[model samples]
Target: MEIDFAEYQLSSQLRGHEDDARGICVCDNTGIATSSRDRTIRFWTLDESNKRDYTLSKILLGHTSFVGPLAWVQPNDEFPEGGIVSGGMDTLVLVWNLVTGEKIQTLKGHKLQVTGIALDGSDIVSTSVDCTLRRWRKGQQVEEWEAHKAAIQAIIRLPSGELVTGSSDMTLKLWKGKSCIQTFLGHTDTIRGLAVMPGLGILSASHDGSIRLWTLSGELLMEMVGHTSIVYSVDAHSSGLIVSSSEDCFAKIWKDGVCVQSIEHPGCVWDAKFLENGDIVTACSDGIVRIWTTCHDKVADAVELDSFASQLSQYKCSRKRVGGLKLEDLPGLEALQIAGTSEGQTKVVREGDNGVAYSWNMSEQKWDKIGEVVDGPDDNMKHPVLDGVQYDYVFDVDIGDGQPIRKLPCNRSDNPYDVADKWLIKENLPLSFREQIVEFILQNTGQKNFTPDPSFRDPYTGSSAYIPGAPSKSSGVSKPTYKHIPKGPLCRLDVTSGVSPFQRLLGERHSFSFSAECNRHDFSVLCVLVRRNSSDWSASSGFDVIPVTGELT
Candidate 1:
C-alpha cells in the first residue's frame, strides 16, 4: 500500500513507568500492556475523554527484576477471561489475570534470566540465558530441551507449528517437536529479535545491526541493514508491514525489504507493536510509552490544542531564562487567552482593554500580530536601553528575525562619541563603518568625547581593535593579527646528496611567502599542496591561524 508515512504523528504519550520500558504489547483493541525495568507491568486503556490518549488502568507488581517480555493469552476454555504472561531477569515467568490485577501463576525453572516468551497454542514457550527452552502448560513444566549453545535471546512459533529460536551463538534453529530441523546461519552477533511473517517468512534482528529474512526451512532470503546499533524487537502486522525497534533511538517500518518509515525516539526504543487498527506503540528507555499513528482522527482537536498549549508553556519557560518578556507581561495583559478557529488556525490574545491578538502563522512557523498598528508615531517609538543605561535617538533593530530580539544598551548622557565607539565594538559593526556612523551619531547628538576608550573588543568575534593613537606594548605589533594566503605556483626543490629521489618524487611540496605584517601574531599554519604531475599543480587548500582572542575578517 502507498501509505504517506510522513503523516504519522505522535498520537499520545503514556507516562507511568518509573524506569526504562522494556517491552510493549497491544492487549486488545483499546488496551496495552508495558513491562519496565522498574519491576512492574502497567496496563493502560484508551482514555474515554480522548481515544487517542491512554491512561494507566493498573500497575501489576511482583517481579523482582527487569520485566523484559510480555505475551497475551487468547481467550479459550483454559483461559476463559484470557490473561497476560511476562518473563523477566529474575528467571521467573508470571501469569497475571488482567481483569483482577493479580498474579495467577509464577512458572519457574530456568537457571538464569528469562529473555523472551511466546504462546504456542495453549502452552507458553520461554527462552532463557541458561541456553534452554522450556514449555509450560497451566503453571507446570511440560517439556524442556537445550535450544542453543549460548543464551537464547528470542523465540517464535511458525504457522506450521514449528518452533524457531535465535541465540547469542549467532544462529537460528528451527525445531520440530523435540528434534532440531534446520539451522539458519548469517548473523555475526547475538540475535536479539525474531518474528514470524505468516506467508512471507521469518524475520530476525540482531546485535550486528541487521535484519534477515528467511524461509521456514532455513534459507536466507534477504538481509536488511540500516540501524547503526543493535535491533531489540521486531513485530509484523497482518497488513504485510514489519516494525523493528533498535538501540539507535528509532523504530523503523519495513515493507518488502525496504524501510518506508522511521519514527525517532529520544531514547533507545526497546519494543514496538502494532495495535488492532494499525496504530504503533513504542516502549522507550525514557520511561515513556509513545503511540504513533497515521490515523489523525484518533487525536481529537481539543487534545491537540492542549498539546500546543503545553509546548507554548515550555517555550515561555525557556524565554524566562533568556531574559525575554512573557505574554502576560505584554501591554494591557491580564490572562492569556487562546482559541482555535474553524479554518484550523490558532489565535492567542492578551485579555484586557488594550489587548493585542496574535494568529498562528504556519508558513513563518511563528505567531503573527492579527491587527494593524494603531499606536501613533510617538507611542510606537522606543529607545534602546542596556544595563540601566539608555541611548538617545538609538532604536532597537531586530537582526535575528523570528528569534528573540536583543536590546543594545548604552549610556545616553555620556559623550555621544564615547557611547558610539563602545556600541560599535559591542555590536561587532564592520571596521569600515566605524568612522562614518560614529561621527554621524556624535554630530547629531551634539556631544563631545570627554574620555574615550582606545582599546575595545568585538563582542561577536572577540577580536581586539586598537585606535590610531593608542599606546602599544611592542613596536610594529599593536594587536593580534590573522592573514589568509593562497599557496600555489609550485616550484620543485633540488634534491640534495643525502636526499632520496624516491622520497622527493613521492613527497608533497609547497612554498610559503609571508607578508611584512606576519610577525604580529604567534600561530602556526599547515598547508597541503597537491600536484597532478611533476609540473602541473592541481589544487591547494589551507587555513589561517588566529590567536585565541583574535578573529579573521
Candidate 2:
C-alpha cells in the first residue's frame, strides 16, 4: 500500500530527560518506556480521551550510566503485568516491574558496557561491548559465549525462535541457542540496529549510512540508502512498515525497500519504534521524545498541508538586472565614412589614427570582420595604441556590445595573441571566427605537422600499458600513531585540543573549532563558543551556533 507522508503529524513531545534520550520500547498497547543517557527510564501512557497527549506515569531509576537499550517482556502467569529490561553503560542489566515501579533483578556478568537486550522464551539475551552474549533466566546467567570479533551493538529474536546479533565488526551473526550458525556480511561499518520482518527478512541499520535486508540463511537481499548519516535504530511493524532513526536527524519509514515517509528532528535521532497501533515514537539527542501518528480528520490534514506549504514557500526566484553602456551609444557614430558599395562592400569608420571596420558578405547577408581593426584611420600605422596597449590590430564588433560584460577583468599582457584567445573563448564567439582564430593562432605559433604522430599508439591495447611501476621501499619517516588514551575528567585542558571524548570513542574524526571564556574570581559563570566546519561533510551537516551562558562551578 502507498503511504502518504503528508498525513503524518507530530502528536506530542515528551520533555523530561536532562540528557539524550537514547532508547525506546513499547511496554503495551497504550504504554511506552524511554531510556535516556541521563541514567533513567521514563514510562509514558497514551491518554484515551486525547490520543495526542501522553502522561508520564513513572520514572524508573537504578542504572548509574547511560541507558542504551530496552526490551519489554510479555505478561505471563509469573508476572501478571509484565516487566521491562534495560541495559546500560554501567555494565549492568536491570529488570524492572513496570506496574510496581520496582527493580526486580540486576543481572551482571559482562565486563564492559551492555549494548543491547532482547526477550526470548522465558529467557533474556543481552549483548555487551565485552564481545559476549549472555542468556539470563530467573535473575541468573544461563549461558554465555563470545559472539563477535568486536563489540555487539544490537540483538533481536526472530519469529522462528532464532536469535540474531549485529556487531561493530560489520557483520551480523545468526545463533540457535548460544552457538553462532551463520554470519552475514555486506556492511563496511558497524551495525548499530537490527529488526525482524516476520516472514520477509531481517533489517539491519549500520554506521555506513545504509540499511540492509537479509534472509534467515545470511543472504543479503536488498540495501536501503536514504539516510546520509549513520543509522542508529530500526523497528518493524506487523504490516511490513519499517521505521529507522539516524544521526542524519531524520526518522524514515520504509515499505518494500523504499522510503515512504520522513520525520525530521532538530537533533540526532537515537531511536525509533512502532507502537502496537502503528504510531511512531522517536527519541532524540535533544532530550525530547516525540510521537508521530496519522490523523483521521481533515483538520489535521489541513494543518499538515499548511506546514508543507510554508516550507515550500521558503524558496523563491532571485533576479538581477545588468546595466551598462554599449559601443553603439558612443559619440561620433555619424562621423564614420563608407568606403565601398553597400551590397558587397566593407564599412570603415575612422576615429583618431585607427578605423572601426566591417566586411559585408552578399550570400549570408551579414557583416564580418576582415582581419583586426584598431582605433585609427591610417592603414599604414604599424602599431596603434588602444587601452594602454600597442597592438598591430584590434577588432571592434557590435555582437554582445549592448549587453553588460559578464566576463571578469584580467591583467593586461604584452602579447596580444594570448589576450585575444582568452577574450574570444570567454565571449563565446561565432563558429566562423572560432575556426579563423584557431587557424591564425596555429599559423602564428609555428607547427611542424598538422597530422598525428605515427609512433603513438592507443594506450588501452598498447604493450607498455600493462607494465607495473617500480615498487618503492618505505622511507625512514615514521607515521604518527595515535594511542588510545583513557578519557579523564572534563577539567583537563588537553581534552579540548583533539576530538571530543564521544567522537574518539566512536572512532569518528571531525573538524571543528571551539573557544571559551571564564572568570577566575567567579568560577560559576562561563561562556563557550563552538564553530562547526561542515563544508567537507554533507549539506545537512551544517549547524547553527547559539550562545549559551550558565553556572559551571
Candidate 3:
C-alpha cells in the first residue's frame, strides 16, 4: 500500500517490436506482456533490478492481420487456471493458459475484425468492426447484441453488470443485459478510448482532442482539454492522478483539474498506465516503452540542475541596480592590534603609538588593555619605556606562495655570511626557529631554484640555494587500467524468474597494480561490475573511485 515512486533513466532502449504494440497487460505476479502489430506476443518477467529481458513465449498465429486486444484473468480458488484471452482482426478470440503457454480454446463468432475487449467474471466481452458485441463463456459464444451504429472502437462493463460501448458514430451507448439502455450524444468526433471510475463516473477520450467525463446517468461532468492532437489512451490512479497519452508525442499527468507534469517522448505516446509503484509506463508509437516519475512538490528538484543558466538568463532581462548604507567603524574595534606580550595574550589599545604593556585579552572582542594607555612619559621618571621591541618584519613575510615539500630536518649552512648568522646558537633555543627560516626561503625561491642545475640562487636574495626536489607527479601511485573491455553486441537476453548472468570477456587481464594517475581537474571513468541479484547496486560495488592510469589517459 506504500506509494513511494522510484525512478529509472534509460541508458538504452530495446526496440521491442517491428510494429506498434497495441495491447499490454501486467500479471498478478508483476510479469508484463505486450501484443504488437508484428503478429506476436512478447512476455517479460520482472526482477528487483528492473533489467530489460523479454522472451517470445508463444507466437499466437490465429490472427490474420494483428492481435487487437488482450485481458488477463486472475486465478480463483475454485479453478487454479490463469489465462489470457485475446481478440484479433481475424475475427477470432483465443484463450491461452498463462502458466503453461498453451492455447486452451478458440472462440469464433465475430464476422469482422475484433477491435476492443474487456473481462467480466469468467466471461470475455468483445466489440468488433461488425457493429456487434459478443460474449464468450469458457470457449463458447453465449450472447450477441447489436451494440452500436458504427464500428465499436472501445468498450467496458459497469460494476452494475451493464455494458458501455463507444462508437465511430459519435455516440456512447449503455446496454443492460441484451437490451439497449441509454445513448450519450455529446461527442462531435469518433470515440477512441474509455475508462470508468466509480463515484467519479465515466472517462472517455476522442479524436476531438478532448477527454470528457460523464456520470452514469449520461450527464456531462467535465470536458478536459487533453492534447493538441487525438488522445489515444487514459488511465486513472487511486491517488486521483490521471495519465493520458496522445498523438502529440507526449504523455501528461493531471490532478484536480490542473496539468502537473508533461513527459516528452521521441514518438507519439500511444498508451500510458500507472504502475503499482506510482510510476507511469508509456508505450510509444516507435515500438519503445518508457517509464516516467513526476513529483507534486513546488518546483521539481530536477529543475534545479539548470538554475545557474536560468539566473544568467534573468540577468540579461534587467539592468543592474545597487543600494547600501556604508558604516564607518565600531568605537572600540578601530585601534585593535594584537601584541603578544606573553605567549597567547596580546595587548590591545586605541592608540597608534607602540608600547609593550601588560597583556590584554585578545580573545575578547573589545580593544581595552589591562593597563592605561600612556600618552607621554611619567612626570618623575626620565626613562618610561616599552617592555620589548615591537618587530614588524616577521609578519610581513608572505609564506603563502610555496613549493610544497615533505618535512625534513634542516641542515645548518657552513657559510658565516648566511642569514643564520643572526642566531645565538644557544642551548634551549627552539628548533622551530631554524625550520621557519628554511620555510621562508622555500616560499620565496619556488621550483626554479630547486631544479637540478647548479648556481640556481635567488635573483633578489642570493644568500642560499633551494633544496633538492622529489619527482613531479604522484601518477606512480595505485592505478587500474581498463584495456579493451569489448563493446557488447546488441542481442536480447531472456531472463526468467531467477538470477541471469551475462558476461563479456575482455581482451586483456587486469592485475592489482597500485600505480595511478590522479587528475582532480577532469572526471575519470569509473567501472562497476554489478552482481545479478543485488538488492542495492552499492551492496555489490560500494562506491569506489578508481583513478585511471597512463594507459587510460
Candidate 4:
C-alpha cells in the first residue's frame, strides 16, 4: 500500500495496570514497558489480540519504593541483544535480561532514593535524591561524584568525557569524577531533566517551564521557553531535534530553539524521545505513549505553550501553525495516512479494510458509504470503469497519464484458467474490462485461480511482497518488521483524476527498469517482470535478477 503521511493513526494500545502511569519505553525488540503508580511494571507484546495485549512479564519486586524512572538498554553496536535497566525511589538500580526475565548484577551505593539511570557499554551512571551521582563499571564500583548540592533529578554523559547533572537546586552542574567542573545557574525553579547532544554540549529542562542550552564551561548559550507547565522530561536527537514532556500534558519538539511540533495528551507528559526516523515518542500520565512524526509545512511550526516567557531567549519566533491535535483514546498514534473522494470532503481515513467509507457531517456524525468506491455496478453488471480500459487488454494495460498503453510478454502462473482467477476478475475488475483483464491476468500472471475481490486493491509497491508476520501471542511481539520482497516485474498505473482504484494489473510491482510513451491526458499502463522468490539484497552482497527487456500493454 502507498501510505500517505499526511495524517496520523492510532495503533494498538498496551493496557494492563490501572493506576496513573509514569514511564513508558517501546523497546527496540520485544514489547513495551509501562510503569504505574501502582508500584508495578507491565509489559505489552505486539503479537496478541486479547483484552489486554500485556502480561506480567516481570513484576520487578525488591524496590522498597515506587518506581520513578525506567530505561531500556538498547542493542549497541557492542551488544545486539538488549536488556532492561530500571531505577526506583528505593535508590536501587536493577538490570534485567528481557529475554529470560533474569535479573543481572545489582549495584548498591546510593544513600538516598535513585531517580534515574543511564548506561553505555559496561558503564552505568545513576542520580539520586541524596544529592550525589555515582558511576559503576562492569563488575566493580568505579567512582562517585558529589556534583550537586540538592537532589539530582537527571544526568547525561557527554562526548567530552564529562557528565552533566540537573538538580532540584535550580542549577545544572558538569562533572568529571568526584569533582565538579562547572556550574550553570540560571533557571528560576528546580532543574528537572537534562539532555546532551554529544558535540553540542547540553540542554536542560526546569520547573520554570523552559529549557536552557548550556556550554560545558558553565556558560548559558540559549534559553528556550514554551512549556506552559513544568517541563519534566527532555530528550535530544542528533538531528537538532529536542523533545520535552511537561505537566502541560503535551510533548513539544524544538529544532535549534524554535518549537516545531507539540503532541498533547490527557495527562501530564513524563518522558519523550526522538526515534531514529525523526519521530517523537512520548509517555504521558494517562498510561499511554504517543508517537508523532515531523512533517514539514504542517502544524509543526507552532510554538509550545508559553506559560512563562520572561526568561526565554530572543531567538523564539512564531511561525505558521498547522496540525498537532490530540485524538482521544489513541495514546501511541504514530503513522498516519489520508485518502478520500475527489469531492475533497472533510473526512479522515483510518487504517483497516472495513469495506466502508465514513464521512462526518457538520456535527461530526458518521455518514457511512458502502465502501470507498460505492456507486459502482451491483453484484452483477451495470457499471462504468472510470479509467479507459479495453476489456481484452485489461490486465495488460496500466492506467497511465493517457490511454492506449502497450503490453509486454511475460510468463503467467501455471494455473491461468483456475476458477479463482475467473472469480477475481468478476469481483475485482471494473465492468469495462472485467472479462478482458481477467483473461490477461490469467495468461501472464500465471495465477489461473486469480480472482479479484471487489474489496481488493493491488499493493502499491514491490512484488511477491506478502504481508508481514503478525505478533506472536506469547512471545510478546509488538512491532511489525518489514518482510522480504522477491525480485520480480511489477506493473503500475498513473491514472489521472477520477480514476478507479483497480485500473488493471499490467505488470509487476518490483523490477530493474522500464520505459514508456504517452500523452498528457492519455493514461498509459506500465509493467515489468520480477524474479520469482529472489533472495534479499544486502549492502555487502547484492543479488542477480532475471531482467525483463521488453514492455507490456
Question: How many Å off is the CA of 464 in candidate 3?
Answer: 99
User: What is the model-wide C-alpha lDDT for candidate 4?
Assistant: 0.54
Model 2 segments beyond 4 Å from truth? 1-6, 297-553
Residue 38 accuracy (lDDT) in model 1 = 98
The candidates, ranked best first by lDDT, are 1, 2, 3, 4
* Candidate 4, 1-553: lDDT as tens digits: 3422233222223345555667666575466676666666655554454322234466554556566677677776533556667777666787766656656767788888787776655688888999877777874668776767788888776776667778888988777666777889899998888878657678889999999887777788888889999998787876677788899876777766777666656667787766555556566665654445534422222222131121122111111111111112111112113333223233222223112223434343334342342223333212111121111122235545565543422223223222222333333322223233334445444444453332333332222211124333344434333223222333333434433322332222343433333221112212211221232445565554533333321
Best by lDDT: 1
**Model 4: CA > 4 A from native:** 1-12, 24-34, 42-64, 74-80, 138-140, 294-553
TM-scores, one per candidate: 0.55, 0.55, 0.50, 0.48
TM-score of predicted structure 4? 0.48
Q: Summarize candidate 1's per-residue lDDT along 1-553 as a digit string, tens digits.
A: 6754444567888889999999986777648999999999999988787677888988999999999989988666656666789998999999988768899899989999998888888889999999999999978999999889899999888888888899999999999888998999989999998998868789999999998999877788888888989999888889878889999878999887789988767678999988878888999987988887887676535676476456445544333211122334343322223322223242323343233445555555555566532345355224322321223454343433243443433344554334544554454332233333444444444533423433545332334443334345344444222122222222111223332222232243443333322211111111101212224543464442322333321
Give the range where candidate 2 is weakest over 10 consecutive residues by summed lDDT: 316-325
Q: Which structure is stronger by lDDT: 1 or 3?
A: 1
| CA RMSD, predictions in order | 21.3, 23.7, 25.6, 24.2
Q: How well does candidate 2 match the true structure in TM-score terms?
A: 0.55
